[model samples]
Target: MFGGGGGGGRKPLDYEELNENVKKVQYAVRGELYLRASELQKEGKKIIFTNVGNPHALGQKPLTFPRQVVALCQAPFLLDDPNVGLIFPADAIARAKHYLAMAPGGLGAYSDSRGIPGIRKEVAEFIERRDGYPSDPELIYLTDGASKGVMQMLNTIIRNERDGILVPVPQYPLYSAAISLFGGSLVPYYLEEEANWGLDFVNLRQTVASARSKGITVRAMVIINPGNPTGQCLSEGNIKELLKFCFHENLVLLADEVYQQNIYQDERPFISARKVLFDMGPPMSREVQLVSFHTVSKGYWGECGQRGGYFEMTNLPPKTVDEIYKVASIALSPNVPGQIFMGLMVNPPKPGDISYLKFSAESKSILESLRRRARLMTDGFNSCRNVVCNFTEGAMYSFPQIRLPPKAIDAAKRAGKAADVFYCLKLLEATGISTVPGSGFGQKEGVFHLRTTILPAEEDMPAIMTSFKKFNDTFMDQYDGYSRIIQYYITPSVKT
Candidate 1:
């Protein structure tokens, strides 16, 4: 009675009337994981979050000096009070002032479009030390995070019509999202999982040729060293080969080295792309335009909330450098505190300093714990029946291949879901553990996988592992036919 047939003329909003590419993209894992967790919470269920690489959320604390420096910079007045003198470090105070003096608008206001000169200089020094090569401050630009810088670079190179970027399959989503949003073609090359997630030069050449045949100009090749999700670190030999390939192909090389400090294996040390370029010498060094990105979000700091990062370009043309600066200028400046935070990350306390020993030990312990956790998760997954997981040599995720049964696949399809996604959803429902599916990161057509972070508390990890194993066993039992199909594909048959 309140609303009759002709009550009021109101039309519904058609939110779907937007970009076709955006419509095609899906970020279902995160949303489903969170939603399911919330639902479980309603029933008073305790959920274990393995879907995101957030250390702080799992009770990992930040280093004292870094946090103190940030807080002092954020509010200088607190430092002036006499009672607070004992609470802050004298060296930290001096560092804060130095940062403020170097910051544009004196840390209270916005900075230049590129970033503060002081921080850029510090970044250059850090690069020089790390790469054992000369670096220019002018070539560096501080960003809110590496994600923004990558997107900016993509925007400049990808000029509509025929532009494309070569991204590894099972890549970080940021690359795909940016390319899709900018209407640039995404030419994906597969990483060989059978070979420890190695870069397949044959696949690379084939993908590039195919893209060119389709009239798409492959402008750049994006490499996530210490590969995301898969967690494979590139060797020096591999780096040399990749650099040579990029040089020969005239491809702009984008090296994502945010996880430079997260290497757990002793044999595979983190190698800088710029270092590889310089060591190669001659035309390879001069010909390849490499932009290496670093961030405080990963590694020991794990300061994802800070959004502090930088990109250093080696052998870039002066004109291109200016173009990058001009584009970055639109942002006016990176966040002032974030710039200061980046400075601290690059140039931490020296060995002779008062806090140096403690700081060093604490940082090392955090990294060691992360390494142990990575091993625990990978080992646990491998122990489960029908689950195969490679060692996480570096990076924060364990991407495991799960053998699903026919019924599970059918059920997923019936529910309009990805097979791994269905598997993960059931995993969350049964065990309160959430993870992202491999399809979200672009895996092979028929294979199903899921990515779980190794950032949960060490004490709680075993329980998480047990839950995962139990759920996987239950799922396999329920969907034996799907399991058979997966087993048939993965295991070779023996002929009598």
Candidate 2:
């Protein structure tokens, strides 16, 4: 033993030595339940993961053209193989070669700290096509995923515990996790679930004022347009109002628009915060800083493993942008294949191009499947006793509110668990259905909900729904003693 001088008897790193901020972080999507599920899977149980918006995990196939190009780039020698044309289309081969030229040394090499300039340009072009406005490639940062960019932005904004972010209740846990990790406060604003999960400005104002009253300096607000957990897209009018709120309050707007291409409702099409801000012109555009995040993970591409995403900074100070780049530099570069994937995602084949037909067909098929799954899951959940789910207008989740029996709540308490977590664990155990509890995402006190992705294959949904309904019914039956109490609370008897 070296005593206090060296290694022999020194204690290993543990919770006490960990960062306090790290200790506060809890991401329930892959928390205890998911870990248990994984353990069960290793034991050969067929667990269906509905906990996260991971499409490919649920059998969503990647698009042909992107994969082909990626494959060719990964093995550029494939282009020289005489059978290349036999396996890959002409356009894919050409695209791969093009990206190779763009990359400093193809997939093996690191790109510019910001990203490949050409790829960023393509991203900018994609934005211009989407918004009818110009985008600067220089303002873009290629990230491992949209989440990295979001966390980086939070890092720049949060200086201490006094700093807070205005985060929506029933939001994706990423925002909350990042705020915790950054040692910042999450000033909660409850979204109106009764009103199709609408953002109530009155609630926002009150939340901001209350946080301010408590000396929490609210510096940023996050909007997951085509929302996560709650899959309702923001109307243009609503977006305009939100922009106004940010402008008046001097809060930065963080737009999570990764689901921009996942819109299913014709009436509720996706709109970028940048587009709205620019349309408002000058003061609105100049004053309010907006950072919008997009990814190749959630769209029809469903290339979650690629880890490709970008965040465009609007109205941010040039100096701040430089800081972001400097931070990115420490990471060396975003994944090169991911950067190429981003390019493919933003600039798919044109109509006249050879791969156009296949690309369009593949993209359309995936979108249609997702739309069908969303509708099917929403209907099934709404039909369940004491459960209400709004139809998903966009994004890939159905966050259904469950009315837990008081008996069930008591049972959960006895188990030292939240009621929704108790319900989700039961569902998982009974039917191999994994889900994230609303407590993890934040919900009104006394309200119980669970978020399930609509990413399961269409063919598998009917059986999944049947299993879910049966488990729910059986669980409710077990808690029948509290059913009458819930009924009484909702509808009191009138004495004549």
Candidate 3:
């Protein structure tokens, strides 16, 4: 009945005929600028890649306890060996054995479509401890990474082109890329740069109103606590306000809390949306739909390559939960080793565990170093000519606003690039510092910025910042200085 051979004449997929949605997706984290950085690396240039929040690639040492447990799980044969304890700590061996028992078929075998049940339990416990609220294992779904979970939820919500998701302007490019790929509208609410990139409730209401006026049905609101690029951790008070807004507006809350543990500012510590909702009690907790996401890719552990993450749903209808499960079942299973890593991350060595001391010291050192690097990079940008950056309160990035002269804007126009993109290209050429332009992250028009991770090695961070300062000082002087020279030449003869 099916004309299989008839499709043979269709030739290779024509770029012109490809899905327009696919064509619309643009992940600036690995966009044209990233490609150029890769080219420079191949040509033997020393490039400091701050394009994405990839910590291990930037020299962050992996937490030993997780790696040890995972290494044993990867080769279960070693666990049975009598002398395996000689090389591995008792707690790690025990933990590995516990997880191995849960997955009798081993890490190589397929897990539940959701994840390893035991590990999911551990994640639930971790959440309970962190938020002082109960989290259900059945509601949690382990994903290949938080990004996969985000796309899955987006797919569930975006039934058609007019379905809109309220996303932050200057957001992680993944949100934009996923919205485009799924053929959904992205309604943007801008964070106020004048106020440490904080959210403004009035602005949010206006954005939502604007989207609805255009006939788009706004479905969900995404909040990246301890935000990416901007790195502003949402206070608990702020989270409560967001919950109220979502409840009143009947919008789902998608909280991206991957940077929960990366917080550096005590005054603005990380707070989960789930916690705030329950704290508000009654109507808000019982009715407002919420989906909270976490990943092993971020924070001090920095297990980006492992691709372990999870999202917990709250207040969703049973049928909706079943549908999400059905979609996950299509993937067969999440990454098994990644699930194990997620377990370790959520339930690391406790006080009496043999590896506790080493784990504590290692994780603490990494975090302290990152805190210092965050300050170093922020201060470096502030000191640079025509550049001002907010302090990185949590996430691994510094988004510095660069005030360019008219001449630079003209140059960028002639080169057929956004002003910031042109400036980033020039920065890469001069100092091999690869950063994503603000245009990539959907900044407010006429204002330009760039995103850089503070993940470089601590010893080398100073030198990196110094190198960036040298190049930036020269860039500003060349572009911003041109205006002064013209102004001097045209000034109506100043009578002494």
Please give the RMSD to the true structure for each candidate, in Å.
4.3, 3.2, 4.7
Error of 3 at 270 (Å): 0.8
TM-score of every candidate: 0.93, 0.96, 0.95
Per-residue CA lDDT of model 2 for 1-496, tens digit only, reads 5546755553556666778899899998889789978988998999999998888888988899999999999999889999999999999999999999998588998899999999999999999999999999999889998998899999999999999999988889998999999999999898887678897898789899999999999999999989998999999999999999999999999999999999999989999999999999988988999999999998898888999999999998888888888888999999999989999999999999999998999999999988999999988986777776788999999988788888999999999998998998898888888889999999988988999999988999999999999988889889983442342112122110
Show where candidate 1 strays beyond 4 Å. Answer: 1-16, 19-25, 28-31, 38-44, 104-106, 481-496
Model 2 scores a C-alpha lDDT of 0.89
Positional deviation of residue 210's Cα in model 1 after best superposition, in angstroms = 1.3
Model 3, position 429: C-alpha lDDT score: 95
20-95, model 1: which lDDT tens digit per residue? 7666555544667667887887899888777777778777889888888888788878777896668887778888
- Model 2 clash pairs are none
Better of 1 and 3 by TM-score: 3
